[model samples]
Target: MRFLIDFFPILLFVAAYKLQDIYTATAVLMAATVLQTGIIYGIDRKLQTMQKVTLVLVLVFGVLTLVLQDERFIKWKPTVLYASMGIVLGAALWGWKKNFLQILLGSQLTLPTAVWGRLTVIWVGYFLFMAAINGYVAAYYSTEDWVNFKLWGYIFPVVFIIGQGLYIARYIKDDSNGAEKS
Candidate 1:
């Protein structure tokens, strides 16, 4: 349910693009994001930071794409978002000596400090890689291609998550004993 709600904007954007054009798609995306955020807030009574960021960026860039009659702004939004995430994660791990992934999810998933550090590095690298991929596709590809890339690009995250889950499965503790199996 929540996944569909969150993805409503992207789905709408793609549909609008197919039906009309980029400017129309941008407007639909902007409106859909606003509505999604509002609906989430009404249901949950709170908004995640990323939800807010998505709303703001969609509005800002979507409007730019509509008002200026250029699709570049909307195309660049994902790259900017991915780069910001990478910078923040890298700074927290390297500069502050903090494993943010552990800080955020430590209670749910217990692991050695080394594993947490490695997970952090993996996340940072993934974000950087995604940012580069988005930038490259947006800069060099046609609008149709970029839209197609956005749809297909979801696979990268799915693969990353599955791969990470597999990697961490070996580290999970034995449920009966509450001790990690060696």
Candidate 2:
């Protein structure tokens, strides 16, 4: 559903890369991301901030990759995106004295204020770690290696998200018992 839709562009990019070349894959990724955003907007009538940022970065970096005939542009995209998210989260938490992650998800997940703060810290660390890894792989590795990492690196986020779910499970209110439980 939403997960597939969000990943639609990356999936298409990978398939196109396998079928053709980097330029072709870049074009496909750009088009697919635009289409994905359009479909989301048509249904929701609004795009999340992160979605909009991703769309813009895909278009900008994708076009640069095509225009400059350099794969570096495309390869650097993930690092830029991850770094931006990390910066925003860290800034919100420290500079603004706010936890934007908690603010964003507070409506859906009810937790003690302390839990929310800790969750925000966890997300900030996760994002920073991802950013660092992306930067490292993009800089020190070959284009082929970076592309391979793009596919395999998804495992990190998946594992992190599952860990978050497990950590939050204990905090979620139980409807059956009408109380929180460990």
Candidate 3:
């Protein structure tokens, strides 16, 4: 259910693209993202920082894509988002000596300090990799190819999330017995 809500925008965008064109797809993406955000806010009662950022970026870039009649803006949106996330996480972890991921999720999951630091570093690297790959594809590929890549790129996140879950599983404490469980 949650996954559907989260993915419907991209799914709609792809459908719109296949039915019409990039401009139509951009419009659909904008509307779907707005709807998605509202649904999430209604359910969660508040928006995460990333959710807000994503909404704003989608709207801003969607409008630019429409107004300027340039699909590049929409295509590059993911790259910008991924790069910004990587920079923020990297800067917070290295320069400020603070782990933003830990600060955000610490209340929900208790992990050793070192684990948090390592997790943040891993996230930073992942974000950077995503950013670079998206940028490369968007710049060098045709619009159709870029759109296909967008549809297929779900594999990267799926794999990363599964790997992350496995990595953290051993450290998660089992509340039933107050013992760590893998």
Candidate 4:
């Protein structure tokens, strides 16, 4: 459910492109994103920080898509968002509040500080690379190619990152039982 909630905008954007005209799709996506954010806040009884960022970005990029009548802006939205996250994570890894990534992901797993810093740096580099690729594809490649790359390019890196995280999690032995056995 949380995953679906987080993915609501991306799924909506893809569906909007498939179901109707681009402008109409943009409108539908904006509505769906707002509704999804609202639903999350309603259920949790508190607003999430990411909800605000997602809502603002969706609205801005959706409008950019409609007003400029170019899908390129919409395509670049994720790149911008990811790059922003990368910057913040990179700063955190540099010792400016090391808890940043942990706060975002700690519910799922715990890791040593070195692992967290390494993961953060990897994410930072991934975001930087993704931004450059997005710019190149949007500028030089065909629209169809850009869209295809946008969809497919994201999958492999995400899968690889998750796999690496899982491997790290496995090596993070449980400490709770040590005291009991001692």
Candidate 5:
């Protein structure tokens, strides 16, 4: 399930941290991530380029965590992941294609291009904020704080996304109403 897919990494991160040996934990995390990716790909019968790229990045960073013996590399993983998704989503708004969020939900939802653009910008800004916050926390806070933030910091983006959806629902008419026409 999508819920599990998102939560699994965080759970692994906690496990890795608790295990206390960066190299061994990194290997375990990397293996788990690969398996996760493979399962998703098998179920879908095709791998999204983004998913493949993400797996690669995670592996690379996980290895870096072991090699460098500093948790900073792993700590910044979400920041890079979110920033990349945000940029890609924002760029998709420039063309006719809606980004990942829309692709997943658009069948059951409706919103105009302007609304989508606004949503994308909001996401982009949030990602930037997350990246900055992650850097600050990892640099200044203890490892425990960094881990807690990784789990709890998801709140900000979820709230922002819900707010965006509510705003779109208020302003944008349903798809059947032809409100999405540019």
Candidate 6:
């Protein structure tokens, strides 16, 4: 259920692209994202920072794409988003000596400080890698190819998330028996 909600917009965007064109797909994506955000807010009673940022970016870029009739705006949206996240995370970790990831998830996961730092670094690297790859594809590929890549490129995030979960699993303390699980 959560997975479906998270991917609702992207799935709709791909379907719309297949059925129509990039502009139509952009519009569909914008609407689907707005709906997705609303659904998330309804379920959680609030919106996360990332969710808000994603909604704003989708609407802004989608509008630009439609108004200008240029696919580049929509295509580059992911790059911009990924790059911004990477930069913010990296800066928060190194410059400010703060780990945003830990700040956000520390209440839920009781990992060591060192583990949190490492996780933040890993996230920063992942975000930068995604941004670079998306930028490359969006700049060098045709719109159709970019759309196809968008559909298939989901594998990256899936793999990253699985890997992250596995990495963090060892550090997650088990409270069932009041003993460390790992």
* Candidate 4: stretches off by over 4 Å: 46-48, 95-99, 106-108, 175-182
Q: Candidate 2 — number of clashing residue pairs?
A: 0
User: Whole-model Cα lDDT per candidate?
Assistant: 0.89, 0.88, 0.95, 0.75, 0.75, 0.92
TM-score of 2: 0.92
Candidate 3 C-alpha error for residue 44, in Å: 0.4
Give the candidate order by descending lDDT.
3, 6, 1, 2, 5, 4
**Model 4: per-residue Cα lDDT at residue 32:** 90
Worst 10 residues of 4 by lDDT: 143-152
Query: What lDDT tens digits, residue by residue, belong to model 6 across residues 72-94?
Result: 99999999999999999999999
Model 3 ranges with Cα > 4 A deviation: 179-182
Which pairs, if any, clash in model 2? none
Which candidate's lDDT is highest?
3
Q: On residues 50-149, what C-alpha lDDT tens digit does candidate 2 reach at each position?
A: 8899999999999999999999899889888988998998899889999888888888888988898888889888988888998899899987777778
* Candidates ranked by TM-score: 3, 6, 2, 1, 4, 5
95-163: candidate 4 lDDT, tens digit per residue: 576757677877777787777777777777877887787878878987657656755675857686787
Output the lDDT of residue 110, model 2: 87
Q: Give the distance in Å from residue 46's predicted Cα in candidate 6 to where it truly belongs.
A: 1.1
Clashes of each: 0, 0, 0, 0, 0, 0
Candidate 4 matches the true fold with a TM-score of 0.76
**What is the C-alpha lDDT profile of model 3 across 1-182, one tens digit per residue?**
98889889999999999999999999999999999999999999999999999999999999999999999999999999999999999999999998999999999999999999989989999999999999999999999898889989989998999999999999998797755552
